[model samples]
Target chain A: MNLSWMAWTQPTAIFFIVIFCLLITMSIWEKISPGGGPRVGILRFETTRGDRLFLSLLGSAFIHLAWLLFAGSNLWWAMGVSILYAGFVFSFV
Target chain B: MNNKPFDNKAWFFVLPVFILVAISAVIPLMTVVNYSVQDSFGNNQFFWAGTEWFTEVLNSDRFRDSLVRNLTFSAIILCIEIPLGIAVALAMPRKGIWVSVCLVLMALPLLIPWNVVGTIWLIFGRADIGLLGFTLAKMGIVFNYGQSWLQAWIIIILMDVWHWTSLVVLLCYSGLVAIPEAYYQAARIDGASRWKVFRYIQLPKMQRVLLIAILLRFMDSFMIYTEPFVLTGGGPGNTTTFLSIDLVKTAIGQFDLGPAAAMSLIYFLIVLLLSWVFYTVMTNYGMDAPEKREVES
Candidate 1:
């Protein structure tokens, strides 16, 4: 059993193949339907411009990191604060 | 389904949520993906293992068993919660201060952290001093989750239902509230029975919300780890070990990075596929509805 290549080797191959399949399917779907699917609303900055996308990404990252700093080590607290911040952002912006 | 044609400006409002989900979901996913293809010997050493781990995971009995258990658990939870939630939603009052109170109370469990939910149930289901266990014992039921796999499964399932059924109820309640009073008035004028009114009007309105509820519940239940882990520790052997538990044990506990990553990827795909199926089914059904067709026309 220790010498067998099937132990770890087989599964890793299958995993990536599945991921590849997923990526391909998503690409095909996007091509076929264009704007028919749901957009990355809260995660995607509403701009198609590179500058705006970059700003939104950086700003959102800092907001998350700042939340973790304030909320301590608890993941739930961090999540809660980040969600509240997001809600605040939506409300104001 | 609403077809209200919301403005694109709403995307800007939603940007922050997407960012947060990306950090918590996408980054960890990428890390797992990185690990899945590499062989590591502890100290940051990596070698291309190609597809070795993926194939191994696919053939492993442990992976198969965990997947089966996860699928079964999700199915059972969906079946129990959806109908039960509808019933609870129907029973809730349409108006009054009590409605607010009940809503707040119902949401309390959802607000509690996953780990805390686990801790609460761990203590709550203890055979010695826990209310549930003590009462069951006194009633000669001999309930001991620690010792019996069936008892553990029962308790875990019940705990999940208790903790999450409120979410289903809330969604269903919102769906129910969104129905216009005019529909019910018409039903009353037409001498429709309560059951008939619920069947013909309320249920159809609820389909969208129910689809969301079922998908959310299924995904969450499929990925469930903390509560059951805290309660039974996947103990009395591997009988209670779901996919997430096994994946965690393999990844973090055994440091079997390749297998763990592969398992996580498989787990992720299963969820994605199932969710897609649910979305497609719901959308197709919604589009096929006679009223929806008439309204569209």
Candidate 2:
């Protein structure tokens, strides 16, 4: 939490911490099961779990930005939408 | 299908690289994200404004115009550079001492710093003093890039083609040389035409490197700032004020941190999405070709 060196806000720091946690959780999941083979999805590419995580994160960023542009500053709706998108990416892509 | 034993111990080896990337990239990127959602007054006073800048920047005429310019520039450069690079690569000598000399010469332009390349063209295109414009002035035709938008565009595009076509040529040349002699000998024995030889053997071999060349060129052109900035300061008028130059004017000149930060994030996302699309399309295109050939046979 002592992030003055980089001048990070609490929320922004928490956002990155969540991403870091996701990575750790993913590694642990991979270790427990170990068969995250690349699967061709509707996106038409072979993507493993890691790649799907990446896709979800990237998609979420765009979704958040788009939401801000069109729907204004109430971003809780955007976060909900992003969570669903990540679910969709994980399940299918 | 990596079936090696799943060991938790392996993560430690990758930790140093992860930490380095975190320090270099993620930390700075977080700072930008922090600024994007906040309003900052002088002397480090900040208040959370929550995406007001993002909406403003996205809706602005200036941002939209600069984006269109950036896209057009990337498209024009990619269209010109890729084929030219491939053609120059094909024309290169494949044997003897000439190959090294040719490579060194090809690399000379790339060796020049980008700003220096811009400065060189700035002087080189001046009508009264420089060779290109002076020679044109000596004839009936007179031109000044500073005065005309079209002339500025022409000079910037010409300068880019001269500077970066070498990169494509180098990548394609490396791809060409990797093709075995046997393929050429077989093609020759088949009495294949020059075009057929190129279309079938040489091109398929160059596909990987060409993908790399195209991706690099597209990304570089989109993010281009130094050369055109130095030459015409993003060319001339509304047409040549690409996103980067516009971003700098907002961030540094106006010192509008919120809008600039928002623009930077938007710009970063656009590049990331396009690069992803390009990678997907090129890889799938290459993958489909061999499978289609197999099915036809």
Candidate 3:
């Protein structure tokens, strides 16, 4: 609620930290196996692990925003739904 | 996975680019995300808004209208430029001194600064002193972009086509010239018709470049701001106010930081979604064909 230089609120920082961690994890995964595992899923295209991560993250952001608008501010349910959605994306899409 | 040795030194080369991206894109984007979730009064004071601005922007008729307008513009131009570019590229000499001349001419418009491109069109479309406007007047076609929305749209579309069609042409030309002489010789030996040659050989070769052209044009046109802003100022009753122009009006013209920030996130999300869809669909379509063909053969 209080302003700071560059608007570095705690939650926002956490959001970015999570994204950074995901990137580092992905990099490590790639280092272990240089060829990313790309497969055709429900999306009907070849998507590497990195692509799946991107799709999941992008979809989750929209899901989060939509839930915030329609279901009110308690985002715990939205978070749960997003996790299931991400799992689905990783497994099949 | 191939057994390539680990090379931590690669990260040293990549780190500078990563830092640049973090400083230029990530930091600024985080600031926007922060502003989007907070309400701001003057003097840098802020209160938690908690998605209120997102709701407001989503519900606004102005946002809806501008989005529709933006999508329509992008669609119309893509329809025109892609085919037209292909034809022009096809017509150009595949090998000769004239190829260099053609390339230099095509690149001229792209080299001009964007605002200058806007300024050029703003003057060129003026009914009083401009060549296009004067010619239209002489032909008995009444032309006033300030009063008529259709006329304003015409000029904007025309300006865009003139400025950007070269990009498509250049890309398609590259795609065309890359076709080895053997393919053409084979087509000739087969006695294939012109249309057949293009359909089987030339068109398939051009597919990758066409994808690049379409993606670039879609993103650029969807986020267009400067040319229309300079030319029409989003006037003629806001008929030409696309998403970026409207976002600027919200953020800078009215100085509403929260709503503007929220609008930007929405805009970015839409663009990201569409770009990904286009990328997936195009890559999927092209990457599957050879497998099927090989199996059938």
DockQ of each: 0.03, 0.50, 0.52
The per-prediction tally of clashing pairs is: 26, 0, 0
Q: Between candidates 1 and 3, name the one with more favorable TM-score.
A: 3
How should the candidates be ordered by TM-score, best one leading? 3, 2, 1
- The lDDT per prediction is 0.75, 0.87, 0.88
Tens-place lDDT digits, model 1, residues B143-187: 878889998889889989999999999999988887878888999
Candidate 1, residue B35: the lDDT equals: 80
| Pairs with steric clashes in candidate 2 | none
Q: In terms of TM-score, how similar is model 3 to the real structure?
A: 0.88
lDDT of 3 by residue, B1-297 (tens): 676676778889999999999899988899999999888876877788877888888778999999999999999999999999999999999778999999999999899888899999888877788899888888999999988999999899998998999999999998788777888899999999999999999998888778888988988999899999999999898999999999999999998999999999999999899888887766676456445434533
Cα lDDT for residue A80, candidate 2: 99
TM-score of each: 0.68, 0.88, 0.88
Candidate 2 lDDT tens digits, B60-101: 999999998889999999999999999999999999999999
Query: A1-93 in candidate 3: lDDT tens per residue?
Result: 444756666787898899999999999998787778888787666789999899899999899788877887688888899999999988997
Number of the top DockQ candidate: 3
Can you give the lDDT of residue B107 in candidate 3? 92
The lDDT leader among the candidates is 3
